[model samples]
Target: MDLDVFVAAHQAEWARLEQLLGRGRRLTGAEADELVALYQRTATHLSLVQSSTPDPMLTGRLTQLVARARATVTGTRRSGWRDAARFFTSGFPAAVYLTRRWWIPTALISTAVGVLVGWWIATHPEIQNAIGAPEDLKAMTKPGGGYETYYSSHPAASFAAQVWTNNAQAAAICLVLGGFLGLPVLYILWQNMLNLGVGIGLMSSADRLDVFLGLILPHGLLELTAVFVAAGTGLRLGWTVIDPGHRTRRVALAEQGRAALGMAIGLAAVLFLSGLIEGFVTPSGLPTWARITIGVAAEAAFLLYVYVLGGRAARAGDVGDVERADQTATLPTAA
Candidate 1:
């Protein structure tokens, strides 16, 4: 059959099927059977039409039909409860995928580099001197000396502003670099890890490791973990473009981009909160045990939400499932 004729036939059938579906009434067995047969035929025709010469008008019409069909299947409006539940559920799968698939590996690799380089630099007094002379080393080695002194001198507003600006810049770098094939993203990750290692090494040298831990661990755990998550998202996004894995590049990019964006947004929010904590709470002379306890508890809460709460939420209203239908029915519809 001619391509135009084939598309026309399918388009007519697709429109009719859409109308039937849109009626929003239960279909009789015969009507449902007929609709299913028509759907299958239309799908076959669409495949053929796609492979043949493309018509802009037909393609547009088909796109519209498909979008309408999707809306009908997914529902036109979502409740706030459903939205919150979905956000929670979607987060864990992304976190799990990131941790096992990318974050943990990247962190391990980066940490290894940081430890090796940091250890060498710490042990070699000459290199340390080059980075900062022996006289000035006190400032470098001490936690509440250089940057901390600057921070302490600044007004509360200025300090808060600096923290927010710095953290936002870091998050933006992680997100934007993901589009550049992940090399830039990896570089950002490495730089962060390197800085952290050097900071710890310097503190160890000054015999103020406990002070550093009390100051940074309070918020560093959340802040650093969020960065790792952001970097993982970027890595996955870059990999999707480079290696599409059985799907077309465009399709894979779309799918991976959605997942990556979700993770990136979640991480950004986390980093923002971490920055607030670091700026306001960390600088205070909180006890080491208190800092450790807060850090551990914060991590525990995050883990529970991601692994348990999030998982349950995602499965809560899965499309086409009985649970979803029951939940939807319980929601009050507009009169």
Candidate 2:
């Protein structure tokens, strides 16, 4: 494998391919055929040189030439809009639907924990006393109190933006921290449940449970669902770190991480809708039943998206990852 002899042999073919590529749209049929042939030959030369020689300059030049020729052969790719269309239609939902086994139970268990804690606090006066003075708790639960006024504390637009930002941040944390064996995600979920339980307990004890439900349900259904999705996806990622099944740990983490990131983007949009409801519909003069109906509808639609669209995409082998061409891989070590 004399580097000089190899370069001398293939240099003309590589130069011809480069010249054809530089010709752009003006290439003739014969030139196009020649270009393809030279490109293949140069590719083999690249492989040979890579295996038998350590000539960095020659390898780099051939790499660049082959890449340029490939672009000329294949033409440019599709636009960004098409990619976005594909993502929402298939990738995002598929990722969510695939994680149903993880998230559905997360939702159920989180809800159960919140309910149990709320019930206990409502029934136990001593616990309430320990939490705070009865007067303060009473004030918060009373009509036109902290629970009711919190939604209206700021202008509607500002309030919606604030809520959206806060929730999105929480969701992002749950997703990114999932790689740390899911411990942080668990803590986040527990803290969320505890806070929700305390609020429900205080409201119920004050006989303002209806008020609490009316306001919370309108936004919470979708909002909490988004959070649960994040937490669930994160846990799945952590579990992948522990047990990657048939795939290597690195591959599993990368695949699941991409899926989790897709979920994060989808969840952001969901949380935005929830924030809108919280700022406008929840605190609006709409009847309690009407507001709750809107929340229920939104939640149902999201589930349908996951199960129908997502399930279809998953079955078709969409894993919410980038296109195959965009994936990173190491060169084969063996011939």
Identify the leading candidate in terms of lDDT: 2
Q: Model 1: which ten-residue window has the lowest total lDDT?
A: 324-333
lDDT of 2 by residue, 59-111 (tens): 78888887777777777676599888999999999998888899999999999
Q: What overall lDDT goes with each candidate model? A: 0.64, 0.88
Candidate 1 residue-wise lDDT, 31-76, digit = tens: 7776676655655555455556556776566545654554554557
Name model 2 segments beyond 4 Å from true: 1-79, 330-335
Best by TM-score: 2
RMSD of 1: 7.6
Where does candidate 1 stray beyond 4 Å? 1-48, 51-61, 68-75, 78-81, 89-99, 133-135, 142-144, 150-165, 310-335
Clashing residue pairs in candidate 2 (N, C-alpha, C atoms within 3 angstroms) = none
